[model samples]
Target: MKIVAVLPPVVELPEPSPGYLFNVERAYNLHEYFASKGHEFVTLSDAKESLEPHLADMSIFICSPFYPAYLTKELINRSPNLELAVTAGIGSDHFDLEACAARNITVAEVTGSNVVSVAEHTVMQILILLRNFIGGHQQAVNGEWNLPKIGAYAHDLEGKTVGIFGFGRIGQRVAARLHPFDVKLIYNDPYRRKDLEAQLGVKYVSFNKLVETSDIITIHSPLTDKTDTLFNRDVLDRTKQGSYIVNTARGRIMDTAALVDSLKSGHLAGYAGDVWYPQPAAADHPWRTMPKQAMTIHYSGMTLEAQHRIEIGTKAILDNFFEGKAQKQEDLIVEDGEIVSPSYKIK
Candidate 1:
């Protein structure tokens, strides 16, 4: 079988120490593994345009959420031999699930691969925004240490209310990690688990209440039609003035314009997230110049450890596909034009 592995540009890193699992030179170790197993492997930097030449021969397509090669319905229909789509990490939203299901292309992801990494990043950003660490760090780097100017916006995490939207695996982990910080934690999710809420000491509040009362709001929800632009001007208007937001989930969850407007008007204290609406966001994207933001290139979930887990999980899914075995039912996002994940079901 022939496999085409599509990924972002190669990143050269300093040589790893002995015993390190990741070696910088041999990038995409999984590609090497599949090649050794007698399968033809082809790697491409950007499959969006380059994939056309290989679609006729490629049997399986592998991509990552960080640098997705969007598989449109037209593209899916064009690839007569394409059988499976594998996300190197969690979140299958990059692949149009409905389209994949309609075309009978099995969609799978490396679920839970980066939950800890992203949850930890959420906590880091929450503290960074809450304590105004970015401003303070900038002041120090500029060789200016004005105590009052730096201290004015900074505050202790204790006693402030923190609300998490979408109490999924990552959200639950964020709440559990913050429990030691002595801050009030609350969350909003459609299907509330009373036991888990009590265990985490997190209150299940309405979406409006969570937005209105939270001193810091973090998003960990998936992106769907219902959650697209979940945080707009109306939701921001309800937030406590000067509150911060940290989103490690899909970027489209928040309206970009509303976020910028709130930051400009001083309604929002700051915003931080590693996800962007368009992966490899356009050069002139608004978030690039948005004030009081600590955004990066959607790498929160691409840590070294995460890469290993995703590589292993992706290879396993491919093995199953090659052997004509069914995908784990729990791992199937869209199998045949029907939503299998309970989270996607209409209430």
Candidate 2:
């Protein structure tokens, strides 16, 4: 079976670096690994390039969530031989799961491949926003000492209310790491786990309450129909005034325009995260110029360690798929024309 990987252009490091494990040319070492097995493997550059040109005979489509080639219904239908859609890292949201299921295409990701990486990044962004790190850092770089400007927005994480919108692995990890910071933890999820609440010392709250109560709202939820633009104008209006937001989840989960508007209106004191919508985000994306933004490219999950874990998981999934063995239960998003993972449930 032919495998086509849609990844960003390779980073040509002039010198060797251990961190280049998942670059397009290296690709978690899949090219050499698969080549020895007599299977065809190819790598394409960038997310915007049309996959249609290469999809005609491809059986496996592998892509990273960091730079995705969105496989819509039309794109999915282009390849009758395409049986599997694989995420090199942990998010399969780039795939239209419903469309894949309708076409009996299996969608799977390297589950837990970068949960800790993302969780750590989320916490870092939270601190960056709450403590006014961006302002201070910019002042230092600009060769100015403006304590009043930076100190005005600087806040202590201690004794603050932090509400996590999704209580999944990444969210749980964030809560665990933040527990010692003495922040009051609250969360809202479709499924409530009594065990987590007891162990993590967190309480379940309604969606509205989560926004209204949290001094800092950190989003770790997946992008789904219900969560698409879930944090819109109305929700931003409900958020605690002067509160900060950190989203390591998909960018579409928040309204692009509303987020900027809130920051401009001072409703949200700051907004920070690494994820962005239509990534390879346009040069003129408003979020880039928005005040008090601590945003970065969507690469929190692409750490070298995470890339190694992803390599293991991706190899396992591909090995299973090619050998006609069963895929990992936790990794299967769609199978046999049905959505198997509960994480994608719209309601």
Candidate 3:
């Protein structure tokens, strides 16, 4: 069987780095194992047009969240031999679940692979925005130390209301870490996690209420039909005035232009996150120079520790498939010609 691995373009290093475990050029050193079994392994960057030619014949395709080869229904139909799709990292939102189910394609992601990494990044972004860290740092670099101007917008996390948009693994972890900050936590999720609410000391609130009440709203939900552009113009208009936002979730969850407009109009105090729309963002993307943003490339989930966990999980999935064994239930997003996770269903 042929395996096609989709990843980001490799960085040029003067010498081979032993610790660069997740480079696309090396295929996470997967060739060593696959070659031993006489299986063909191919590597490609995430661009779909370049990957189109190989889709029909490749038996397995591996992808990562950092550089996704979006598996749409059209791409699924074109790939007649695609029996398995493996996500090297967490979150399989890039794969079209309905299409994979219809095509009898087994889709699995590395569950819990980057939850802690992302949760930590979420808290960092929250603090960066709330404390005006970006402006202060910039001022220092410019050789100006004006305390009043920087402190004008700075605020403490204590006694603030923070709303979590999803109560899943990463969201729950974020809440757990933030609990020590002495902030009131509220969450909005379709499925109420009652036990977790008690454990994390959070209140369950409606989506509208969460938006209206939260001083700092952090989104941790996946991008789905119900959540696509969830924080568009109408919703942003009704958000608490001068509120801060930290979205470590999918970029499409909030409208890009609407977010820029809100920041420009001073309706939002600040915004920070690592995710963005049309990632590997263009040189001229508005967010690059948008006022009061602390955005970074989508590398929060690609930390070295997270990469090692992802590699182990990915290898385990591939081993199960090659052995004709069942994959772990927790990691299976779509299996046996059905979408197993309600979070992925088309709403």
Candidate 4:
């Protein structure tokens, strides 16, 4: 069997990080493992051009959700030997589910690997926006101490109404972490987790209420046909004035230009998240300079610690496959010619 990994490169490091599992060059030290199993293994950066040569014969394809090698139906058809597609990190939206199902390709992801990592990052982005930490940090970096300039924008996270969209593992964990901050927390999900309300200090609410009332609305929803561009101009226009949005979820969940308009008009206090449209954002992506934007390349789930867990999960899934054992139920997104995970609802 042949396994190929398409991963994001960490070229910024001058020297190799033995523990940095996802670096294109090292591939988390996976080669020796595959070779030990007498299977061919290959790895490359997430360059579409760099992946073409190996498409036809790789048995299992591994990629990270942070910047995936989009497994479209066309690509799936092209790779005749792709029996399995693996996501080294959480979320498998990058896969064309219907295509995988049709092709009888089993799709799996490291489901619980990055939940805690992403949940923690979501809380940090919330505090950053609420306290105007970016502006203050800017003043310090530029060697300027403008007390009024930064202080005027800073606000307390306490006593604010916080709304969370999509209360899944990451969303619920975020609410649990933020509970001690003494803020009112409300959430909107297709399925209301009423049992967790008291335990997490979160209440279920309608979608309109979540948007209209939240001072800081952090999106944790998956990208689906219904949710793509869900936060467009009309939705942004109706949000509470000065509200903030932090999306650690997929980028297309919010409309791109509509985000700029909201920030430019000062209707939004700030917008912060790591996810973006077009994984390697173009030099001219508007969000880079949008007012009060605090964005980064998608890495919230790629911390060193999270990467290690991802490595372990990916290996576990592969071991099961190599031995003809069933993949863990939670990790199986699509299997046996159907989409099996409750987390995904693609038609």
Q: Which candidate's lDDT is highest?
A: 2
lDDT of 3 by residue, 179-228 (tens): 99999999999889998887898999999999999999999887889999
Cα-based lDDT for every prediction = 0.83, 0.90, 0.88, 0.89
Once superposed on the true structure, which residue ranges of model 4 sit more than 4 Å away at CA? 10-16
TM-score of 4: 0.97
**Residues 1-347, candidate 1, lDDT per residue (tens digit)?**
77887776655549744322322234347657786789888777777777888878777888888777788878887888887888778787777777777777777787788899999999999988878898899988999989899799899999999999999889999999999999999999987979897789899999999999999999998888889898988988989998999999999999999999999999999999999988879999999998988887888887878877876787778778777788877677767667687665533
Better of 1 and 3 by TM-score: 3
Better of 1 and 4 by TM-score: 4
What TM-score fits each model? 0.94, 0.97, 0.96, 0.97
Worst 10 residues of 1 by lDDT: 18-27
RMSD values, in order shown: 2.2, 1.2, 1.6, 1.4
lDDT of 4 by residue, 69-134 (tens): 888888889999999999888888888988999999999988889989999999999999888899
Weakest lDDT window of 10 consecutive positions for candidate 2: 46-55
Clashes of 2: 0
Q: What lDDT score is found at residue 102 in candidate 3?
A: 88
lDDT of 1 at 236: 89
Candidate 2 off by > 4 Å: 47-50
**Candidate 2 local distance difference test against the native:** 0.90
